[model samples]
Target: MIAEYADRVWRGESDDSIVDQGMEGKGVKPIVDGVGWWSGFGNVVAFEGSGELALFDTSSPFSAAQLHADVRAWSSAPLTAAFYSHGHIDHVFGTGPFEESRRATIYAHEAVAARFERYVLTSGYNAVINQRQFQAPGLRWPVEYRHPDVTYRDSLTVRQAGVTFDLFHAKGETDDATVAYVPEHRLLLPGDLFIWVTPNCGNPQKVQRYPREWVHALHRMAALDAEIMLPSHGAPIFGRDRIRQALLETAEWLESLVTQTLDLLNAGARLDEIVHTVTPPEHLADRPYLRARYDEPEFVVRNLWRLYGGWYDGNPANLKPAPDAVLATAVADLAGGAARLADAALDALSRGDERLAGHLAEMAALAAPTDAGVHRVRAQVFSTRAANEQSLMAKGVFTWVSSESSAHANRLGAPE
Candidate 1:
């Protein structure tokens, strides 16, 4: 099943871009006069005449400086206005370049403004933790966050340069999200609402997401019958029917996950049991637009747990857990020792048992990160496992572990 999906995704049948074209420095492509779509780390929709541009979301693994450079190449159109679909750093931090523009009016939902203020207050804590979440360097809270100059509760319309852009608030992936629609152009800019990648409604590292509200947002967008759909990330989609189908299917997918998880929860099922029993609809399982390339259904279940219930997962042991390393060391000792676990992992790898090998190797690495042989075996096992993973989300995480293991091995003078 994974292979079949990979074939479809790789055949260009799906909208997935394995390599981000924008990150490769591809200049912005023109969509309309003064108006164009910049595909890089994120999608930037620009209207040049008024020297106005609205960036959807900030792209990952790229800094605000790079995004600014990409926009500069497209139009010296002075940044007139900017909008954040949500409060995520990727959508908001890149506005530094636009902030310098004296005339730029930043727009966002009222919740977004509150999120920014929270980030400012907890900048140091976020900086330390976000690094682990994204596995990127320079994880520092953006001190100079550019707050939205214009914030609305429900909806608002901004007319500039003979273009009318309507902003609607939707509490989906984030509580404060704005979906911009250009009635004249039939273009809908849904920040994270409609990324080509899997809807991150259930990010394991983040806060609660409103799945029911998210589905409503998609239904609303579908009703708009927009001709062109510009997502916060990935390529621009054309055609009203195609756009509507994608939106509706994505919403259905989220709704299914929510309903199924809720059913399991009401049955008094445990979290693990709920995750294992709940499956997304088979049709959506292969739909390119609904693929679990980033966030998985299990995480969605957890998100649902948070939404209906509080943070507690009803698991007493996990309510206030000890440090990860402390638990890992105890587990390693139960398995005899870190070396015994490493040997077991090697055996699992030799038997082509990636799942078992991954488990054992992770324990060994965590228990003894400096062990040369352990790191060597871990790098080899994880690298091969990552190559075989189909989902981009799984592949990225495994790849991060593999690269980290290889670097650790080199540092320990392990044999290549």
Candidate 2:
């Protein structure tokens, strides 16, 4: 039987799509009796107690204030505990509003501490990665993080007014991933584990992700027969059968991708070959919840190769390859000049051959960064490529290239 009060959730194709089109400071929706979640750039899962409350995650800094205000509308109780699903800045940075005092204990897997440390060391690197990955050249990665008060190695449980939350750790998108289960409600809250998209276990620009362990985590949740499932990024799912099926099928999708990719890796296949080879089962790929809207199966394969192999991609030339400028200069010289290559890029874009267009465009830019005509064509082609892409990572990178090209052109035209 389906839960009649299941949470009404928001499912966005991409984070920018939701953020720009606006879902910020969105109000809470009911999941069960005392459980609900607020939709923003990310979701905050809230559970109300008689005189206290708990929240699974706080959305990013951009919308955390609004999300906190919205959650307060439903529960005026001071937060007794806040759970960090993982160390992602978006999930862990917004607890300041709920910290009525230092008395509030925070829970997370112990692995998060090391992840936080690494993030601190790589703050500038992360900032640049985010700018290129999200197309926001001005954005900065938040350095401040709220460390956990109580951490578990594997799993932990807490009870408040007879409501039991069993928090389990399993690696999916990150090593410190946590999946929460409430026995009384038969509801599951696994932050990014069960987003209603092809699982993002294979982000191209991030650290290693655990697809095999992630599948096992899904299996563990499916075994519980949850009546409702809520993810930090996507809409809530209802009904015991539907929930179980969703969880298991999501597992199947990962298993298929992992198995296929691993076989290729073990066979000594190169990263490029594996990327083009590994494929998820057609049945699992067709599901609405598993669509590759933000991250594709192809990218997942590349990540798998990284986990098992090194960055070499089995190509000796890439071990210490020539700089992009050096290579682009040669290509442009062969093509006659930067202007000719730029025209070829535009022609490729017009013919809808974005892969070829992207190559020619980059060569034109690297060969003649000061040429306004080359910059104009490069910007136009990349902008078009960005619009045509489905995955957020691809779109953001493409848009950044276009934006950079456009800014260069504007800079060249300005009066000295």
C-alpha lDDT score of every prediction, in listed order? 0.75, 0.81
TM-score of each: 0.83, 0.91
TM-score for candidate 2: 0.91
Give lDDT for model 1: 0.75
What stretches of model 2 exceed 4 Å from their correct place?
Answer: 1-26, 414-416
lDDT of 2 at 40: 62
Residue 161 of model 2: what lDDT?
32
Would you give me the overall lDDT of model 2? 0.81
Tens digits of per-residue lDDT for model 1 on 1-416?
32243244434464543224422355566665666666654566666665555555555435678777877887676666777788777667676666675557778888987787887888887775566455665766775566788899999998865578899999888899999998888888887787765677776656678888998999998999998777777666777877888899988888888889888889887787887788888876666566676677877888888788767766888989987677778988999888898899989988999989998898898898789888988888888887886565566667778888888989899976
Candidate 2 residue lDDT tens string, 1-416: 11332322223233312223223445887777888777665778888877878888877888767776788888888788888888888788777877746357889999999998998899999999888987677888777678898899989998853478899899999999888898888888988887777788777888898888899999998898887777777566777888887889989988999998888888888888888777788876556677777788988888877788867898888889999999899989998999999999999988989999999988999999898879988899999998998888788888988888889888888322
Per-candidate clashes come to 3, 0
